[model samples]
Each structure stands twice: as structure tokens, then as C-alpha cells.
Target: MGLENVWVATLTDGLIRADYIAGIETHQTPALTGKPSRWLLDVTLTVSAGSGTKDSWEVSHLHRTLAQTDVYPAQAAEELARRLHRLRRDGAAGVLRTYVRYEELSFEFSYFDAGEAAE
Candidate 1:
């Protein structure tokens, strides 16, 4: 079986934008153990500031073999939205960095700010 999901968000007149996707592939063999009937989760996140502009900067995360079950993709997407909301509420000042760590997997990303030197 194969499954894929995606999400996108735009806020503040396109100043902040994000894209997220999660997928699952079943019936795969493990490279290390050579075990069959293994499942794989692929997750990706792309966030941008000043989207479509010259000064825009983006951050992205990609993870393979994220989970044995397919449920994590949806949960992870929700978590990401929650975190982004919290950051906006707390005045993120442009999402300089972001990260997520759950169970045995972790994702980290950094955004490049063209305006950083001015501050």
C-alpha cells in the first residue's frame, strides 16, 4: 500500500508560507536486517519567509523511515501546525529555526534571514 498527504499555509500577506507532506510505503525490505513486510514513512517540510521575493529564505526537513505505522504522518503534521501557531503567538521574529523530536526520530531546520545583518 502507498499513501501520501500534503498541506500548505500562507499567513500575513504571504510573508510566511509553509508546505508539509507525509507518505508511507508498505511491503519494503529493511536494508540492515533484510526483513520483509516493513513499512516506511517519508516526511518533508518546507517553510519560507518573504516567499517569492529576492530576500526570501526557506527551511526544509526530510525524514525517511520515520515510523513503522502510518499514523505518525498526520500526527506530525498537526504538531507542526501547533508549533507554528505557538511561534506566531509568541512573536517568532521570522522563524529563524525550527525542529521536532519524537521517539527515535528528529528533524531540524534553519532559515536564512537576509535581514539578519541589519539587526
Candidate 2:
């Protein structure tokens, strides 16, 4: 599937959520400063097939200002894709919540499958 479609499916299938996906707003807190610290990526996604039930999804710890040496949106996207791939391997239906954290220059992700509780 195309990148847009993949994102849509990932959200619709509960691999991710619409709310966790940031918008055009930028945040500049004390912890987050400097260039490349505040950025938002607008993506257009379409869900080709629906699961016929509401699927709960969440993504936290997407990015951190302390560790970023450059534009980190692309790296975050890649980490999300990697987590989604791992979630798909389970072959179960329901919500999949993914949490991503930075370990040095790499990203570590943990997933939670809520199963029928997602409904």
C-alpha cells in the first residue's frame, strides 16, 4: 500500500490514533528548545478497509528535544512504521497502542493489544 494508505490503515486498525498525530501547532517548553525543536508534519491518510468496530490506539514518547541533532520527524515516522509492522505480525484484531522511547540514537517501542476491549 501507499504511504498515505498505510498510515490510514494503521490508524483505522487501531495501530495508531488520530489524536496522537500532531497537527500544525508547535510547542516550545523549557525542556524543548533550539532549532528542529518545534515541528509538525501534516499527513493525509485514508483507511481502505474498516474493522467494523472501533479500535483504540495511542502513540506516546514520539519525539524528544534533548536527543535530536537534526530534523527528527522522519526518524519518528520510521520508528512508527517499524512498530506497526511488529504489531501486524500478531494477526489479532483490536486496538494496538504503541509507545516509542529513545535509547541513545535508536528508538525502542512497546505495544499493547487490547483485543475485544478496544471495541
Candidate 3:
């Protein structure tokens, strides 16, 4: 099995926007690392202020889904809060959306005929 994809989306006013597809790297086979490649859904926001041209605003959301590493929900939540706080400090008010998508897909099986094993 493999982690199919990673998706980032926009959300505002209690509404979900279209998803943004993030490029992902897949392993030909699952590894024994004990971590399932998946994204943990998390969102964060940050705000900041400065003088002159240095003044800027930024909004950020933590994306855990589609990750090559496995993460617990608590850890993911912590990351989201941390990132969001940073973003909130870095920028102004803006609706930032962070999400994950699980698609319903089917798979096929294959078989082959071969001679009996030798002792």
C-alpha cells in the first residue's frame, strides 16, 4: 500500500473551499518503519505588525496529512496550534484553510502460475 496523495484547501466563514493538491513522493513498497504515510489534518493562524515597508501579514495552517511519517492526533494538534500561532503573529486577519482528503478508490489483483517448489 502507498500514500495516494496530499491535499491542501481553503476555508472561510465556516465554508470549505476547493482543495489544493500538494506534490507527494511515494515509496514503491511500504516500509517497516512502522509509520504510515499519511497527512494529519491541522490548521493554524498567525498575525504580526511592523513599521514602514517591513510591515507584513501572514496566515498559515499546519498540514499533517500526506506525510511520509506517522503522527499521533495529539502531536498533530500541537503542531497545528504552534504553526497557527506563529502565522497569526506574522500576519493580519485572513481565513486560512487546512484540510485532508481521502478518496474512495479500488484496486486490482494479479496471479500467476508456476511450477511446484523444489525441496
Candidate 4:
């Protein structure tokens, strides 16, 4: 399946909870104060989808500030990795009850129409 949606969740007690939608924006500035200007990455994770059941992990999404300091990049990467680990862990846990949380973020919508034909 294509990227219909994206979500990011934090895990606690073997359950992943929806955090917030991840928004990514980039800004650039010229030199200032005799120092070279640079680009800035602004990331805002908002809560889009409401709280879901333990099995609902598709409600969350993730993003990060790619142009920020090394720490931010590291943290972002680590957080994403950790979430994936949680997803896999659920299957391994082999628990009767499973819950996956998700954060809602803006997404690109795409679909195929019956009338539209490919070249």
C-alpha cells in the first residue's frame, strides 16, 4: 500500500500512546552579525486524531528539525527508531490485548480515478 497516512506513538507499559502530529517546515536567512546565515527546520507535532483503542496506531505521525543542531537530528532519529521497535515488539510480546497509538499530521492525498487513464 502507498503512504496513506503516518503516525508516531510513544510506548508505556507495552502500550503505545498517540502524541502529536509532526509538521516539518524549512526557513532560510542571509548572513547576519558578520556570521553566515543558515536554514532552520521547524517541526511541530500536533494531535490530530482523537484517542484510539490499543489497536489503533495509524492515528499518529512523525517529523523533525533536520537543519538544527546534531542533538535534534539524533533525538528525532532515535525517537522514530524506538517507535518502530515498539511496533515489532507487540508481535513478539504475544499478548492477547494489543494497543498502538498514533499522532495525526498533514499528509498528501492521492487516489486513482476510474475516468483517468495512464499514458
CA lDDT scores, all candidates in order: 0.34, 0.34, 0.31, 0.34
- lDDT (10s digit) by residue, model 2, range 22-113: 32222332334543343332222322323333575443334222122223344555554554454455433333332324422333333234
Q: What TM-score would each prediction reach against the true structure?
A: 0.27, 0.30, 0.25, 0.26
lDDT (tens digit, per residue) of candidate 4 on 1-119: 21112232222222122233244454555667977665444444554445567887555434333233212222443444444345344322211121222311121111133353311
Which candidate has the top score in TM-score?
Answer: 2
Candidate 1 lDDT by residue in tens digits, 47-101: 2223345677654454333344322334444555454455445443333222223
- Model 1: CA > 4 A from native: 1-16, 19-71, 96-119
Model 2, TM vs. native:
0.30
The regions of model 4 sitting more than 4 angstroms off are 1-18, 47-66, 69-119
- Determine which window of 10 residues in candidate 4 has minimal summed lDDT: 103-112
Better of 2 and 3 by TM-score: 2
Root-mean-square deviation of candidate 1: 14.1
Better of 3 and 4 by TM-score: 4
RMSD of 2: 12.8
